[model samples]
Target: MKNVETNKKIIQKKQVKIYYLSPEYVYYPIYNNNPKFFVKSKSNVFKETLLFEDNNTKNYSNISGQVMGMKNISGKNYLVLKNDFHEKYSAPKSFRRKVNKLTKKEILDILNENDAASYSSDIKYFINNFESIDSLILNLLICEDSDKIYSEVFNKYNSDILEMFDAISQIFEISNPVIMLSDTDDKNIEFVTNLSGMYPDIRIVLSHDKYPASHPLLITRKLNLSNALVLSSMDLYYLYSIVKRNKKVSEKMILISGDALNSDFIVETKLNVLISDIISLCKIKLTEDDVLCKNSAIRAEVVSIDDTIDTTVDAIIIAKKGNNNPKECINCGLCNKNCPQKINPQMYKLNNLPFPGKCINCNMCSYVCPRMIRKDI
Candidate 1:
């Protein structure tokens, strides 16, 4: 390979890589009830079998396996099962629908019928509350540099994603529907640019590859919209899968990346896949010095490797132990300047003021910290 100078600002597009995990076991976390709901301690389960239903959310088994009763993982109870390596589904596959012609109520019906939509999801909240949206934006880059779940999905399904976006705009009667991609994503930019003539309602806007810009509050300011329904790429993908692909929701995307690992990549695996299974399938090792964090590296909850990927987790970061001791604040103004909500984090850091109500709880202050002083503000 010849040495070539490249621009540091622009991130060249890489081939879309997806790692699949053939799990020997799938752990279904129990939420509302005990695992011993049936008469037998062991039973066979098909794919998409109803595990349990609670709080208006139905849980399903992601694989066909032999149930082995309850197993506790990291203090949480999960109904474990041994996989038979057979992907037998309880229900037959659905036929694809002409989603573009669907009414708003019909679309909502589809979301409600499927397991992908939830009562507490951000997308569902916005959709149910709005009569009409001003700007419908899909946020592909959500402030995490190593989290490539969104962008990688976009890379693999750019054309279909654009079609779905257009259909959503038409169905919602949104006057302005935009998608925010990283400015350095030239491959996606060119791909969408060539197809821009087909979908006039869909506008592709490049977002800054910097912190705080992808925040909902700052995104509205950047797009100059009164009110917007901003969704993550995964959020829209769930809807897309329900409408465009007409497939029952089974697999979920997760990004496993950190300095402790050899490289960064995304994994497309079944829902509720165990973190330990992901690590083992990917051949990842956790040394004594390395720590595992859920969703974020510095400003996230520390998790054990046995944790299962529930609805809340999007990324698992395995980080090497470094100097995490908080240093004295040097009166730097980065926290104040980078705050998307305009509430000064410096006052709270110094114990001069309590945590303000206006704080959006973004990690901008810690992300911009030079001395790693403010890890959570």
Candidate 2:
């Protein structure tokens, strides 16, 4: 295997402090524009209730609630729900004790039946091509686009995560399964390192704590990983919840951190709950002038408090708004130099060059700028 380059700088982003938030409301976008719902308007939805499904994944209610009505935002329809706060579980919750005993068909069925797929193609890919996969790589690092790590889950659900991880590898024709963690994450590194001896089949490897280190493509490239099923911590969390805890997919852990607040934190809240609600519930000290970036600070698009969290949304960075006035580009050339894909973002802006065809959206071109002026232009 190729070695992880030591030249990469360590990422200073902090861990998402865990919080359980029960917002009064949550919303779900109408899947494929018009979804065939098992629940209608004013219908009572218990927790773990299946609302919809597609070829890739399934959607389940995270909270017990009454469907209030429909909401339309920017031509998209959302099912608005008022949380009853009871968290009543749907009927027929099943738990599997002997994970290793599960057959290939049974594993696929459980993933589909219990909403383990959870709006991600990662799980769906297993159902279709498990036989062809040569390795299973569990990416315990944060999502590529975000600044927070789900390190807490590795400690909290270590046994279940590893259990499901090993079982999936055993069933899916995977031999050299690897669980990748950020070396800078001392908490997870310590926990997993200590517990790894029990699961001798699974190997624990540390990735450089660097920006874009969480990117799956970069990871595969660096590790020389091919024919590997790379999955995020969220995927495994859903697997553990669905398979072990017998819980439905609803609440998700998201990073709510930035200098705009007194402290940085993460909230495990009902999906599609308003960001404003979470801020208020957590007593986050965000002001009007403070900017909220949906994923990364390098991302130019700002998300307002009115926006709802979708399943795919991983973070809301509350930061004091920076100066929008343009500054003359410094001659440091860091943007061009640091770009992993070697895209000349400066030329795109300074010379009116069309944006390069192979931009990977690493955001390094924007993040490395000393003036913070280069936005992958």
Q: What Cα-based lDDT does every candidate model obtain?
A: 0.69, 0.69
At residue 112, candidate 1 shows an lDDT of 63
Tens-digit lDDT track of model 2 for 1-377: 01112244424454446555577778776657556677788999988777765434456677888988778866766778888988887665666777778887777777766655545678768667888888788887753324453565566667777888888888776998888887766877787778778778888888765666666677777789788888766677777666665555666778776654545566777677777778877776666668887766555457877777765667787656665554688777877776767777776756656667677776776665656565544
The superposed Cα distance between candidate 1 and the true structure at residue 340, in angstroms, equals 3.0
Return the top candidate by lDDT: 2
**Which pairs of residues collide in model 2?**
62-250
Candidate 1 on 1-377: residue-level lDDT in tens? 01112112322234234555467777777766533354234788887677666555667676788888888766778778778878888767666566787888877777766654462267676557657567788777645534466677777766666767788888777889887877867777787788889987788898775655667777877889976888776676677777765555667777777654656657778767778878777777778877777776535567778778775677787766555666788876877887767778877876745567877776567655655655343
Clashes of each: 0, 1
Q: After superposition, how far is residue 37 of candidate 1 from its true place, in Å?
A: 3.9
Q: Candidate 2: lDDT over CA atoms?
A: 0.69
lDDT of 1: 0.69
Can you give the TM-score per candidate against the true fold? 0.86, 0.82
